[model samples]
Target: MLSYAGIQNPYALGKYSVEKNAKVMQRYRFIHESLLRIAAGHLPAREDWDIKVALGKHLYEDAEAADRLRARITELRTSSAVLNQEPDAALSLLMDELIHARNDLELMVGIYGVIKPALLDAYRSHTATTQQIVDQPTIRMLRSMILDLEDQLSWGEQMIVSLQQSGIYGDNGDQFKAGIASLLAAAGGIDGQQPKTAVLPHRIRSHEPYRIPLKSVRDPRKMGPVTWARTSVLNPPEDPVQRSLLAKMRVRQEEMTAAELIAAVLFSQKNMPWEFYRDLARHLWDEVRHALFGQAALESEGIDWMSRPQYTSDYDVNAPKIPGAQYAWLAIGIEEGAMKRPGKAGEFEFCRDEAKHPLMTQFQDYDWADEVVHANLGRKWSPDLIGEDISFVREIAKNELDHFWTEVRRAQAQWNEGAS
Candidate 1:
């Protein structure tokens, strides 16, 4: 078999399985509204023992047919929530949760994967029967997804040609991939997730992309040229306290950036962890400017600065430890988490000219595309990256995910808690 860097190359099967897992995973999510509504209608508090015993037999029956109905769930509509079988209020919250899940029930059950068909088919069928699926916004979502995936696939296919030219696939692309299948199987040997015809993600586990939580998200602030410029300046200070505050801000930025760089080193590897390289490069760039931005913001303050944005503390357990982690936590889990939470994009000031916030777009982009990559890495290569006996690595990654998110929220609070 032709090898990229030499002896027994792997990752090809990981890539292939990752792609297929992604499509299956996405199909589960696309149809969630229908499921939420159905669950809400059948048993508003299905997790409650009283409700479970008395009314939620459907969840069990539904679980049995996970494979058959999941595809349909990906295409459920709002109207599906209002079906004859459902109560209106429960249905609303179902849409609300589909729109938002602050509770962990959804994450725990891994409902996004196998049982998706039950929800989507129910909603879609309701749409046709009840005439409630005509929202223009929903239609736009459907159309845009179709277009976006087509574009991604086009680019993915083109890149394969470049990959072929890179001296690795010396004309035996198929055979090369076949050999790597063994590597993937070896990797999979350590992977606890079994690729049953249906899919599921590790619930409550940090960095497991499918592990959805019902956490509320923070929105990114809009930075216009004037605002950006104003924040970047540090006016000369008169008092000793003001001068001291200036110094502290500089030190904080350095600390955060240094911590992030150290964590980046933890992910360093060549050839195999391709995305890790991109993450490392992006983080270094963010760190380079982190202190500069803080300095500029600090200097403008006429009064003594209270505190600098911290990147680590018991509080920042979920705060992003690195730039790539920051982007992933914010862009994937939180932003997408908002799609199912209260005040969503708007709550976070995810606005544009009141309409075109880049952060929101980035959130959507990461949620729909990169999340699949994140999850697949866990599912396909858990052994190789962390090792067969190393459950410790998985534990550590989740701890980091928790810290990374916590850090961002603290940063927001620090910024908001400023001058009256």
Candidate 2:
């Protein structure tokens, strides 16, 4: 049977011209940039653990969305110059206020309550109005983004409710969101298609631009300055097999120290290609996942993971001492070692073959896969940030890692002596 061409369909293309579609994407791209920046900038200072993880994931998700839009926009036009420019100043102002969120409460309300929901709406509107057949590629890209945005919105909404129950999100939540709404109103909404209001709200962040904090803060549960790997004093397991399992889990949970450093690098390093930020965002999120694996493993054994000492020292040493570009190269260098024989691969084998532990095996399997990707990303992009000499980058990275572990050993020694 022959399928009828355009059965029960209107012959007319939908509303947008190529130029108009590109403009809409530009607006979305800028908003995604704002989302990425806010998530990365506030990560170091955001104290809530769950929220911190959400930010790690969201930053990467936002970067992916923006990168997709950038790709689509390039297809729509000749020069990629338009992707680099801000689509609207009022829009930029709105973003500035959003990122300047004074506390976690304000951050949640601004991003979840106001901006992201608006962004979701704008995306839905564009998808609905654009010519479906002519702009099929864009429509496909946006469909995927919309699914992610919806999931993110649901997560954010639940987080807001949790905050409200804890009494952190109060009446001021409405007020803060209103301020953001007014800024968006002045900017003519996320798509820049609405009527622009000339008068703008008094800028809350007028005092100074938001500065990315050099250090990340954690909840009260985080006890640190003690290195996890070198000493078994804090997380001592009696049985040999159990001790080995817990030891590896500790490594995974402490992966956050690495994630925190990556977040700092993303925020501090500027003017790199968009690909750098995008790749680092994924790297940061992967480290967070590794940390969660460790957390979960410990908890499964009826252990209080957070109650034990966390390793805050890795981030402490490198974040202050090194430039972001150098820090990035250092991370890539570490991952290269991690992918080798005695690292992730060996860990996976221990879990699967020797330990006879299915869950830890699963964890190690994915952990190995993630590091492979991270190592590949490092090899591809590290040279661009540092120099083309791979061996030199590796040497510098090794020395830095060695120095960081040396300082960690010294701290552990003093701690052990004090305890004794």
Candidate 3:
């Protein structure tokens, strides 16, 4: 078992007072909520593959850390509910502004550069001030979470550098940095502000849900329908050109769905357990990686994936505003369908042997593995949201897919009519 030396008597000398423990837990809760909000808000605005994957990973880690903090509070013989105590008015205002960032650059600079650094400083200060032996559990949790925060800090800095090099900020790069600094200062600088008793309105609401604005989505044809018929395990394609086309389509579908999944989970964060959101975020990131693999395979064959038309609308755009469970069930069904007989594995084999495409086969192999994991994740979490009834889940999934295809077909007809 793991051990911490020089900690024989936990509460013997320099024991942490109840008030101090309460304060620390309260601050942790504030940071926890802030991280979730940041993750949710930034996700939809960002379309770059690398940045999307990073944000998903960061959100998962932050959510897990928040849970650990809650657990620590419970260990101190205090109710975890107390951690939801009112946040500082200034900090709350700062978070509100951060969430409303106009673009990815602003969101990245505000959250990673400003808010995250302040949270990191707070964690460090807590670790330093609290008696290590008496508060060893909290200390250990803070230390583990600190590593993730540091990684985020490094990534955020690199992102800023990349933005500067790209000249996207024009001659205003320094101006943006200064603006972020000012915002940080307003929220009481890197150490964080003292908590105020004034409660803010509920930020994560089901009614006023956060949806990805259709206009903000990168592809102009994201809502456009596929012209080709849907491929199935029972009726596989034979022609090499058709197979390549199918592979490219699969990549595009995964990319679009992954983006939708990221937004859906963020919107549904309040309705589900933190652990559920955490797991789903990791799955979302994996789907992103799968999309990247698909893109790479197409690029290897000298195919411009972007030039191709997308076949489906985002799930978030079509699904009802309430109960994110609908999206989850829909995703599970889609993943299961992909992994059925003559599915991704069969596709991989065909690419390798018949199509004689080595790189395509490699991409399919990994994509197959990722899909299996995703299906298992769906199996694990779907029951929690809907129930143990597998048939019900499958039914929901099938209906959603059908509706999606219908919408796609309609959109495609309109596009064709417009072209003619």
Candidate 4:
């Protein structure tokens, strides 16, 4: 529903608050969109090596952008200068924020300067003058970086301005001086060493005191995975065809797993959004490892299994997220291509798999986890970016559904021919 935005952080799957979640989502939107753009022009019409190279380079740039973001994450994570008034706490938190900000500013400038020289070399190294850079690789790279900066404005400058207007700062000196002191002593001394379990630093002045429990501990859905495990056992595929199709998928899993890490390294360094690529690599590893387990289960049935396309590519990791944005949930993957896909929501009725394996179930799981944050991203930042209307989010979901069903039917056709 409209409230699904709060589900953005599957890691914190149970946590919810319209305001806080929206802010987190705002950051995600900028990062996610920038990644998608890198692959827009590069994805070729055919599944060939050239296309793969283009995808890989696109992904590499996206990863570089994430690295750029990581350089600044420490700025947010470091101690807050005004930890709601802990005595001389003002002295450290106040001082730290400015110090951290300055360091970040320097880092930003350094990155820009290094990239700027690279851009210049490209222009000098090229065949045409500056006017003809429309197709130049260097220009495209610079454009990606510039767009990244533009997107950052959603929270970059605006957040700082909002902070200034809040009057946490004092006209004469740090307003938090006393509160900072008591808070620090309450937490521990400046040394970060405290006696046994005495109370140390946990208060900040606010309109209300709130208590919240960690949801991951409370939510059963947060468990390692329910569907695949349950489906394999409880709902075995009824027909030989269906069972055989799934068995093939099990074999493919091994192929995917075998190359997952190497694919990740190739994709990240050359093509993916490097920061996001790391996650893709790990997910690939998980899928690969999971495949072996699935194979073990199949071996029990005396099935000699061999599946999956033995191939490698350099493509953007987050590229899957884009399709999932339009079709199903953004799982780490979409198993079928457009023509090779499965069922529809309305026309198609469910068929028992005996052992359940919906065409793109991993993607479905991904959507369930990712779409929540994506929904939240729209509500959280659309007001600031597009102002008040969330029509775009609807369009996005519609597209994802369209793609999803297309693949499912392809899968179902495979099922129909194969399933008894």
Best by TM-score: 2
Please report, as a residue range, the 10-residue window in candidate 3 with the lowest summed lDDT: 226-235
Candidate 1 lDDT over 277-360, as tens digits, reads 333333333333343434344445443322322233321242224333433333233333445443233322432233343543
Tens-place lDDT digits, model 3, residues 256-354: 455455556555546565567666666766766666676666566555555444433554435453334555544575777888788777777877777
CA shift of 69, model 2, Å: 0.8
> How many Å off is the CA of 44 in candidate 4?
15
Which segments of candidate 4 are over 4 A away from where they belong?
1-274, 307-329, 332-398, 418-420
Residue-wise C-alpha lDDT for candidate 2, range 1-420, written one tens digit per residue: 134333222355787888888887899998998788778888877877788889989889999999999999989863698878998889888988888887777899899998889988887877777765677788789989899989989999998887777775557577878899889888988888889777766667755977766555666545543343344336476878778877888778887877877877787777888888888899889988998998888778777666566576656677665444445444565778877689889999998888778888999999999989888877776666676566666777777778777877888787678667
Candidate number that wins on TM-score, 2 or 3: 2
lDDT of 2: 0.78
TM-score for each predicted model, relative to the true structure: 0.22, 0.91, 0.73, 0.25
Clashing pairs in model 2? 44-216
Instruction: Return the lDDT, model 2, position 416.
Output: 78
lDDT of each: 0.32, 0.78, 0.62, 0.32
lDDT of 1 at 2: 55
lDDT of 3 at 397: 74
Give the TM-score comparing model 3 with the true structure, all chains together. 0.73
| Pick by lDDT: 1 or 2, better one | 2
What is the overall TM-score of model 1 with all chains considered together? 0.22
The whole-model C-alpha lDDT of candidate 4 against the native structure comes to: 0.32
